[model samples]
Target: MGEKLKLYGFNNLTKALSFNIYDVCYAKTAREQKDYIDYIDEQYNAERLTGILTTLTDMIGATVLNIARQDYEPQGASVTLLIAEDSMLPRSQTQLAHLDKSHVTVHTYPEYHPETCIATFRVDIDVATCGEITPLSTLDYLIGSFDSDIITMDYRVRGFTRDVNGKKLFLDHPVTSIQDYINPEILRRYDAVDINVYAASLFHTRMMIKEPDLQNYLFKTDIYELPPLTRLEIMNNLRREMIEIFNGRNIY
Candidate 1:
């Protein structure tokens, strides 16, 4: 990296990354659907989500000041972490007012269609940081942390900080697209699209898995046990579901 910008006082620019990840599966029966939801709840409980957020905090060079997590009654989990930059003052000396300035959060939603026999698990994550840290650094890890079939991301830079010359700088770093931060190997597995507003310092990206393997979409069911026709139907339904989610519209 080049020399750090010479800020007049403190870097106040706020950078935020929002992610929506969906994992789709084919559950042949109502029992399987319930089982799928239970499995997801156990796999990504509040405790596990907290662990993931803790790792992310370290990766971005932030200190966790506080955390709040909960697992819903029927299904789902949520985790929130309040963090501060490493360069910030120690907890004893720091004030509690800025706690919301930098934080990381995650919430999960698991649901299914009784008619289609398709189940989807959605995880929403938000990472916002003030000062020198950037949430982009944790993109790869977040993607790999879940079974991401369809993913949508939004990144924005808000507020301004002053330089040594007393001039305001809206954005300290250059970001043409969120895809730039994603790993190349991961990019190969998905077809991606970008919608960016350069002047506003906002970026958006949507991705869908390029290849759909029947085995990967099957939940608690053996692919070998299904007949060829059944497998084909399941594959089509799975693809349709992904397409609808990717486009944010239903197909008639």
Candidate 2:
């Protein structure tokens, strides 16, 4: 463990991180689109998501008290974990103590364009913890765990914790941007932007893959199999979709 802080009492400050990841693909036929959806469902089902969450819980040095998970009809899956700050606490006792209402949750959304044959898989994850646990520590792991064509993240520190000297600290750890926590090698593969409010202890970052491989964006098809003109059109459509998502707006 690192150096401990001298606090008047238990740390009460809460740190929350929200991560949104998108995976874009092109499927020219309805059957292909349905196949893509089924693929995503199987790839990220409740069981797999639960394993990921359990690994994350261990990474952040927390103990899981309870877990509730479900796979929805038609599509999508959800997993939630209730965690405690102290790992040694008995599982049953920790659930009752409620020392910290820390939790990790994930939800999936899979959809496709009616006519365009464009498909997208989206995953939203939120990790919130009180006391010494920091959600930022899990940033890179979560990003690497998904397809991650585009990613948007927000982190904020709330409330206050008092030191032994009676000085109030709004944030226990130093953080300027969520990008700081991402691996440099991974950062090099994407274009990144940051919006931060130092006074309010808020940080946001958005990332989109740079120069994506055309073959990687195609489902059940190959770029070379198409005519030169058709290949160019498909590439343009994929980039347009990525740009629209990164900007959070539709392109005419």
Candidate 3:
């Protein structure tokens, strides 16, 4: 019916913004199972990201997700997310392109790396600029860094709606993440960053980033805080909200 939306890796996302990410997608899991939750950070939130990270922690035993986020840098988890819309579908999260099979392949038996996104796309929007992202590898961040704390994140997002209703009410919610509501302490320090990456999905394949002002319009930058809010408080609040509004979603 229409063209496809595109997603790019942090490298492409940042490059579009005139910045560069040394290494992105830092998660707070174990080095062994680092492959599990690479994308779970402050920048992006998927359905069950934190839970997946906790599972990795339990498997890691005595490991933590916060440690995985900024384990390497002073600024902490240096990564950014870029999103684009106005494609074959509407401007909804569901309408956005995700990891697809045509883009990448992962072999779990050997070993996994979560430092990078899975797929990269070349995008052109209007006449402003050109951008890119890895729709595939970005998933690990969402699915991996659940309970982990990511200090810094920047992204460019663009959304289009297929149906006007989808843009008007289909995505509206009454609540915010506990961090969005209460005491949210971002990263105060940093150390070594550990990137345990994975593919966002088997299908999403490739995506793109717009350009120039379009990049500014679609892209965004955000920072996350840790402590004060208390992980327990965040979890309880998240759980309560999930029960009340999120239906079966892990993150609300």
Candidate 4:
């Protein structure tokens, strides 16, 4: 795996280091050119490049080569996610939390736990919008099915066959488990408050795997298409897998 990846980011580099097969080293600067000594390990160090292609290849090895060194400032942003050229992905959890009731307007501050850490952290979800669906932006509406029999707090424009009565028909997709709806920022906020306690838990980092990928998820995993009971079971299994994976990483 180490030989195959040729991966360069620090995360991938560290992962590479975890294996003994690949070699690693720092590149030599022009200062070292006077006595030019080449590094022997082909696996890790780009510490020196003989020419343009070599340098370009080395940049590929390091993951980014086009940007000027002065232009980049990795620490400039704390956290960012990828975006596709054209994406119509479902409303993100952060966005959904702020949506006004058209049906699913469930409060981020859940009943009986309004003052808990989770609720307090949800304050970050309050956002400002022009009060309408704008291009390159969307007014978060409930996207899931609404069952008419079950009163849905989640509102959506999707399930409507006709607006004649001004009441929409829905196919119910009520949240299966309250725990499954855990928010990411809440964990981040918790970690911000205390290092030791946060460090002691693996829940936050691994929980990212459970997060919905929107379209990619719909196409690849098809998890949303699964039967309700199966989805519930799978979520539990995944949570267990996440916990165990983190636990295994801690083993000596």
Candidate 5:
């Protein structure tokens, strides 16, 4: 292991990771759409989201100071966790000041196109940390926690800290791209693009599944039950939806 760099006082550099994960399906009828929404709501309720975030906190070597979570009225949920970097710190020392600096949040959105019969579920997550704990270490776990068809991620390092010699350091670590932190096995499953500004310390990556099976996108419906032409149509619609989401624009 490389020798750790000693810093003067506390390391104040902030690293944040933001994710937008989309899952698409063909619901066919309004009833099926409603059922799909209900299914997603139950599968990713606030309580479940809290558990996920709590695990993430632990994975990053952070201590949870407080958690606020709620399930919405019709079909959605949100969870927020206040965290601190030093698990060994006394409760009195790990107060709102530290809690406010580090946090994890997740929110879910489920919706359906009434005309197109396409149902989509979206989950948004943000993990921000201060000091030595980098959120990049948890990318694999975060991606695995969701049914992600298309994913967009943004990572930025903000603020600065001082070294032992009193020189200011903008970034404590080296990061050329977010993909470098992701698993190669996961990278093989998707087509990914990166937009990074090295000078500004901002990196962005977008990923879409390379090949989607028809059976996987079908909800509550058997592939053998549908005619060949219907199956082809559903496949096209699903691909179109994924393309639109991956590109962030509608195709005409």
Candidate 6:
């Protein structure tokens, strides 16, 4: 292990990671759009989401103190996990009755356009940890957990921890960008951009899949069956959707 920092007391630094991902599809018709939403809903139900969060807890070496999950009406699922640093609390003492500031939450949204026949599934996850646990370690796992046609992530370290000499350190680790934590293979597949405020200890990264295959965006339709012109139209629409979501704006 690297030389441990001699701290005045418990580490008071709070590191938070917020990840948002989008999966886009062309349903072609209202019925297909409904089917797409239903399919996504069933694919990521409360139970599955709970499993994902539990795995994340384990991956980050955290203890799950409590869990609350729900499946919403229409089409959505939510899961919340209250977690504690791995060795901070005894196993027997960590129970649902206990509460902590650290948490992992995921909320899924499956939506469709009113007139464009475009459908999208978006998952938003927020991981906030205090003390020694850092959420940046799970960046790859979070990206791989979803379809992730377009991804937007924000990470920031807040609060201050005192060193043995009574010096305050706002950030415990160095973070140039969230992309640095992502795997090179994954990074190679996406075009990524970073907007960071180093002085504020905040970093943001946005990514969109580069050279996405047109067939992957079609729901219940085969690209081979479509004429060249029709295929072009669908590809254009899908690319437009991805661009809009990645850039957070609409395009004509």
TM-scores vs. true structure, each candidate: 0.93, 0.92, 0.17, 0.19, 0.93, 0.92
Instruction: Name the Cα RMSD for model 5.
Output: 3.6
The better candidate by lDDT, 2 or 6, is 2
Give the least accurate 10-residue stretch of model 4, judged by summed lDDT.
12-21
lDDT per residue (tens digit) for residues 71-148 in model 3: 221111221112232223334454443221111111111122333211111111111111222221232333233222
Q: Any idea how many clashes model 2 has?
A: 0
Cα deviation of 165, candidate 6, in Å: 2.0
Colliding residue pairs in candidate 6: none
Among these predicted structures, which one has the highest lDDT? 1
State the RMSD for candidate 1.
Answer: 3.5
**Clash-forming residue pairs, model 2:** none
Show where candidate 3 strays beyond 4 Å.
1-150, 164-252
- Candidate 2, residues 58-154, lDDT tens digits: the string is 9999899999999998999999999888623243333212237699999999999957669999999999998778888888899889999999999
Q: What is the lDDT of residue 139 in candidate 3?
A: 29
How far residue 183's Cα lies from its native spot in candidate 5, in Å, is 0.7
**Model 4 TM-score, 2 decimals:** 0.19
CA lDDT scores, all candidates in order: 0.89, 0.87, 0.23, 0.20, 0.88, 0.86
Model 1 off-target regions past 4 Å? 87-100
Score residue 238 of candidate 2 by CA lDDT: 86
TM-score of 6: 0.92
Higher-TM-score candidate of 1 and 3: 1
Worst 10 residues of 3 by lDDT: 119-128
Q: Write model 4 residue lDDT over 1-252, tens digit each, in one string.
A: 012211111110000000001011111233222111221211111221112212222322222212211111211111111111111223433121112211101111111111210100010011111112211111111111110011111111121111223333221122222123334443332211111122221111111223422222121235556688865654444344333433435322
lDDT of 1 by residue, 31-102 (tens): 999999999999999999999999999998888999999999899999999988745434344321222358
Candidate 6 lDDT over residue span 1-252, tens digit each = 245555554466888999999999999888899999999999999999999999998988889999999999899999999998743443344311212369999999999995777899999999998876788888888888889999999998888876657798887676788888999999999999999999999999999999989888889999899999999988888888899888998876
- Give the runs in model 4 whose Cα sits over 4 Å from its true position: 1-16, 19-221, 249-252
**What's the C-alpha lDDT at position 100 in model 2?**
73
Segments of candidate 2 deviating more than 4 angstroms: 1-4, 87-99
lDDT of 5 by residue, 1-252 (tens): 146555664466888999889999999988899999999999999999999999999998889999999999899999999998762333343321222359999999999997778999999999999877788888899899998999999999988867767798888887889999999999999999999999999999999999999898889999999999999999998898899999999884
Best-to-worst order by lDDT is 1, 5, 2, 6, 3, 4
